[model samples]
Target chain A: MLARPAAEKGLNNYMNDMFAFDETDRKIVEQLRRNGRATNQQIAESLNLIASTVSTRIRRMEEAGMLRVVAVSDFAVHGYHILIHLAVQVSGRPALEVAEDLAVFPEVFAAHLVTGSYEISLLLTLRDIDELPPLITGTFAKVPGIKSMTPAVGLDIVRYALDTGPVDSRSAA
Target chain B: MSRPELDDLDRQLIGILAQDARVSNRKIASDLGVNEGTVRGRIKRLQQEKLIAFTALTGMKLEKAANIAFMAIQADTAHVRRIARDIADIPLVKAVMIMLGPFNVMATCLYHDLDDLHRLASGRILEVEGVTHVETSLVVKTVKISNRVVRITDADTLSQG
Candidate 1:
């Protein structure tokens, strides 16, 4: 149900025109979104399709870089005492470089370049609030082309989803 | 919530659906090289066994609802369970966990404003019988949130084993 026109014509054309997914492929993607480690046999059975077909489609999708299945944990239960989101505004270096560097930090779970006042937003986890000052002052602020940062600690997470939404299988039809 | 002993095939099926829940049985059957009927039957059994359950994700669109805070609570041993239950009943609380270390209970709460948050932290939370200390931090924004458990690629790779 979530649809956005690709920012570039080449990638968009390649995905939409060159690589059009069939209903079965979309369904396969859906199944994987629900459980990344789903076996091809299991996926095929769920969709009432041949297992070989499911396997082939999954292989194709993986090569395309459209999806990846990985493990994730809730930091709150894992002894992560301090959770915070940093809204960073950059002035000099390429935003992507800053984002890539931030992503490498073990405490950083995720980072993104977004529109509006901030150029990048980072999600971080730590063992205690005391650990935060050193992380920001020593690492984040030291990144070249640095500008300003607004840190918002996460008090609670109400809801979140990994997949944007169900694949529009109807599009294939 | 019945924990059924899943076979390899069952694990495969669960993995696929865990990533994409809307996949059709026909498509899934094709991919796994199994009969559609078998896929259907297995899914039915999985659901019946209570190994799998489904819930839609909601409230991603941010609203100007209230200020949110995270609080770590330490309580006397005898009063821990009772206090946990009481905090869970508070409607504004979104998530709570019983943790180890200095803080025994960790919780997330939402309020209409700072005053509401202050009232709960000072009045209700502090008033609890066995509470020794409370550390609170306010959340400004959320970058990512997810409940999906990561897939264990290799059992042999597990350190515990």
Candidate 2:
């Protein structure tokens, strides 16, 4: 039907808007990545642009929900020496609702509604290994809709960055 | 321990930065009723201790990610670390963690489609020397992605995100 092409065009437009940054914008983002605390004036000096322009571009990116400048706390900072990846299979309720419930826990850093073998996935930070039992049996057990879970404790953080990185293929082989 | 290693002032400063990393150092110093030197010193000490960092988080483009998978792999223990590092080099593999549970190695990846995911798993991951097995689960929706889901003890600050 004609409706399909129209819907496709709308989706394409939405995608285009999200990644509409030009060469200057990309360079600005690269500069931020190199040093997040760099001031707008510093960035403008390096990029050879106006300070206000750099500020405007960063603000625009933040407003569009595409980027943010935030403080990143190390796991050890809060006594969370253990990082856990849990695959959860949901039952008796919608996965999204359960995921939202899981997200409320301060220990959960990232919670996603997923498919294939599991219905949900969680990345949690824990202070100690001893806290695992109490968390699994006491706290998580009380939460409804969780059927089963398989947890993997991180032995080493090979790589972990919240940023998705640059849009270009430079990072690739 | 029941409490985190922070005093009230540290908690407040951290909370403010958690909300906005780029808040002027002067502003933070003024709000915290401390001098600019004190604020700068605290941040420097914290970074030296590897407690916190300031950075920009670029969100994954909605359209670019047609499939996101958490791939769990079993690798020989001796080479787990090396294998994990190798996997991290792969562009699509965003994160790699050497674990000590049901799976020995885990990777988070963003790909264009199921076929792309398949190619990475089969063509690339399977080719690794130490890898024994691989399992993947595709993400259907992102419930929450936040850098500030920290529980700052003693201050009673638990982020809603």
Candidate 3:
């Protein structure tokens, strides 16, 4: 009985350490979001802080595994026109193992282990629609735990961003 | 295509940027064995074309802490685009996609918790005109989230067809 409370306390502490970011850290993150290629000096100039301070904050964020600077290219521009969201159900083995397997494919952009109608979900970027069948039959067929795979071909993607945005009470009314 | 096509040099620049968006132009130019002017010109063109963007992506740690849901909706097919736009405007919606499979509209949203997800899914999502059905699945774990997943192949082949 004592172990359970101690475990809960530890978990809470862990989460607090993981997500804790002050105002300055958040500001630096916002600046980086605006221009990921911005140099430390440029960010410092824009934020009105020393370059070393900006660099240190960024380095701290990087070390904490909270952020990364990456190039986001339009899939259609690079010839991978078809974007399909896959809902996969796993049964025979551990879902995490199967998800890890799915992540190895180059076409897969995001893979998540979830609960509901499906056990795993994936965002697959195919060069063309023709590549879908081969991928479904050849690659996915070999995975041991997959029970079903449902594909939703993206016709139009309206918004894709990281910002969660503020809570809008209008929705509740 | 309305956008300008990428040439070999453009592809090379994009490929380099895709690896490390923060890499300096001088470094990229030296790595690609091209003049700085050429690299700068191609990067400017790519940015103007909206073909490539540099941004910070939230890692899986933050995603895991948040309540991420995959919400699929079936609305009147005619108003699917309009509904998509409305849903996109809703707070916490990370992505909204009009799909062509079992569901007409699919979205990924972040919520403060299960209660927050319940409010959005049961409230605004259901109240939307023409929306007939809604299915929401809470994400339990994120295995991978990457922006640079596409492999760069032959530039000519990628440019054509």
Candidate 3's error at A15, in angstroms? Answer: 14
What is candidate 3's lDDT per residue for B4-30, written digit by digit as tens? 476877777777776557788899889
The lDDT for every candidate, in the order shown, is 0.56, 0.71, 0.70
Give the C-alpha lDDT of model 1: 0.56
In model 3, what are the clashing residue pairs, if there are any?
none
For model 3, give the interface RMSD.
10.5
Q: For each candidate, what is chain B's TM-score?
A: 0.64, 0.76, 0.78
Order by TM-score, highest first? 3, 2, 1
For DockQ, candidate 1 versus 2, the one ahead is 2
For candidate 1, lDDT tens digit of each residue in B2-107?
A: 1246677777776676555557779889999999998889877765543443322212111123455667678786767777656755556555545554467766
Model 1: lDDT of residue A96: 76
TM values, all candidates: 0.44, 0.79, 0.79
Candidate 1 wrong stretches, greater than 4 Å = A1-17, A35-42, A76-78, A164-173, B1-161
Better of 2 and 3 by lDDT: 2
lDDT per residue for candidate 1 within A37-113, as digits (tens), equals: 46778877888887767765555544444433432222322355566666678887887787777777777865656
Interface RMSD over true interface Cα atoms for each candidate? 12.1, 8.9, 10.5
